[model samples]
Target: MNIQDKLSPTAKEIPPSGIRKFFDLVVATEGVISLGVGEPDFITPWHIRESSIHSLEKGITSYTSNAGLLELREEISKYLETGFSLKYSPQNELMVTVGASEAIDIALRALVSSGDEVLVVEPAYVSYSPCVILAGGTPVSVPTFQKDDFKLMPDALESKITAKTKAIIMCFPNNPTGAIMEKEDLEKIAKIIDKHDLIVISDEVYAELTYGKRHVSIASLPGMKDRTINIGGLSKSFAMTGWRIGYVAAHPEIIGAMLKIHQYTILCAPIMGQVAALEAMKNGHNEMKKMIEQYDQRRRLIVKGFQEMGLSCHTPKGAFYAFPSIQATGYDDHVFAEELLKETKVAVVPGSVFGEGGKGFIRCSYATSYSKISEALERIEKFVTPRLNGTCDKVI
Candidate 1:
């Protein structure tokens, strides 16, 4: 039987996640100081874990309502209101999902239909393009350059829109580049979005991890609330990646459409995760702030290290990633990352896997400890020194 031929063509066409490919390699190897995966190195905080333990001890393991525990939704809604000035009704406009991964997937699936095109901002999270394709929608790449700090330009965005363009999927405090879009930046892009009359899938998973400025949701801007799908989660902020707790705030109508897909496929997010998320939402702010401070220190450390080593790096304003151009090393990103891993046992993800704008760069995450990041910096500098041969121009 030709079983492969019988499978959905779309499923076959989808490539495996690039982030996990290097991660798998790191796992099979030994002594690799990894800066590949974007996950925080911190264990889930003690209090949040206690909350889950308390739930399981009480025998509360059954699935909650498909939209998730109502109390959790209420906390998420309150968090959004207090943090971003965006109000949502826990009963109708909010939903809990397995993680921001599931939230991104369902948001695309809910809004995109066959023959529709979703504009994906380039150098985005690895899943954005694939999720759009899996939803049976065409993905149109809207490239942003490093020269602009990888911010989505209004002209570049509008140029990609057409009658078939159904929505735009964008992440600020972007995954690979670690760039952020402040209120002024968002206001400009929002003007283009408003003019085009399109829906937006704004992934603000790193919203709380900014260095100096606060995150401003494009959805919070006037006239954008009704047309935006706001994605957030505890995965990064609370160091709860394994717990798989995430949420969405959108128009009630959009939430209803997404609920159909979620209830059928996921049924409900794990009840224990919902419980833990509630605890985090209510009391995890101080710990989150402490983690942010550590990330800021490491961010400065890593970016400065790259610049000193003669590789040009933008000082990331948000998130814990440092994306440095490898052109000075006379190698493309893929070759540099692979060769770095093979020679020095240091693992970093190549930028090309992220999209076209990332071709000559590499993404090094600073979500680990200060000493570990410092050691990785030493290894990276040693690896690059001979390759540049003293002719490299210092960008610092």
Candidate 2:
């Protein structure tokens, strides 16, 4: 009769995300300059927002097809072709979901059975492990080195594979670390996947945000189109997080299975979001380019700031985050982040929140204004440098 007793065992077994806990602490404090959350500082483009309003004015408030509106899918198809040289048939290969988050969950659920093993590269986004576990699969964490720029190595992946391995979850232009896999690296991975007949869930939500080079999809590689599920969304690229629209493209059979699960579990993604996303695909490229350029400037500033502060940060090739090592401070990520917040009132997520290979590091999101980033760096320098001189007992 107890409410707690009635909870599912999986719910009880999973621990709260370390990242969310830090976010809660950051939110409670005033005057805190947070480089913690990984979201764009820009508002959704006016044209994109206006498109949603236009749809509402037309009284288009109804559930879209479970697969999504054909118009939106067509736009997505064209966008993919134009941007990535990827070809996906709008009719059978795509299924719109609430966000890339839902696409990840559905793909894991649809493809994995009990005892299946899911290969995850760390330090990854925190969502992947729990989703795999919830789908009755064991998550096998593969540690990637900062020395390697956190790129997923084919050898590391091959070492983790076993007969029970069902899929490899690829998050490039990655979160937390911001490492991106180049085309040659992806070709190597594709060879391994083909050799093992593995399915790949390519999470490319940050594809449009890369700085040094264009984002390459493993799905676009030779022999990979059929085995790869391309997961992308408007949230990161178009700054439409609140809209909750994302999707996946794959072979019809794979998409069909995902569609069935999505229909029963989610019914449809937000209708307005689909309409907004359609607008973005049709006319939002210029807006995305401007934002990406701004982010690139911010990225360079943050990386430079960290290096000047005596912390070694891997110059992230993509995404909006900088993962800087805190080892020189003689503190773990959790301790370093807490002390930094308490002393400098600058909040950042501890890298350990992203799992193994993330210890002694912290993730600083550059999705804020340049002035804020500068001010935060000043505070960080004042708080951390003196500690090294033994002038302060701690960062505080």
- Sequence-dependent TM-score of model 1: 0.97
lDDT for each residue of candidate 1 in 162-216, tens digit (9 for 90 to 100): 9999899999888989899988989999988888899999999999989888999
The residue ranges of model 1 lying beyond 4 angstroms of the native Cα positions read 390-396
lDDT, model 2, position 383: 76
Q: Which portions of model 2 show Cα errors greater than 4 Å?
A: 394-396
The C-alpha TM-scores of every prediction are: 0.97, 0.98
Displacement of the residue 29 alpha carbon in candidate 2, Å: 0.5
Cα lDDT listed for each candidate: 0.92, 0.92
Question: Any idea what lDDT model 1 has?
Answer: 0.92
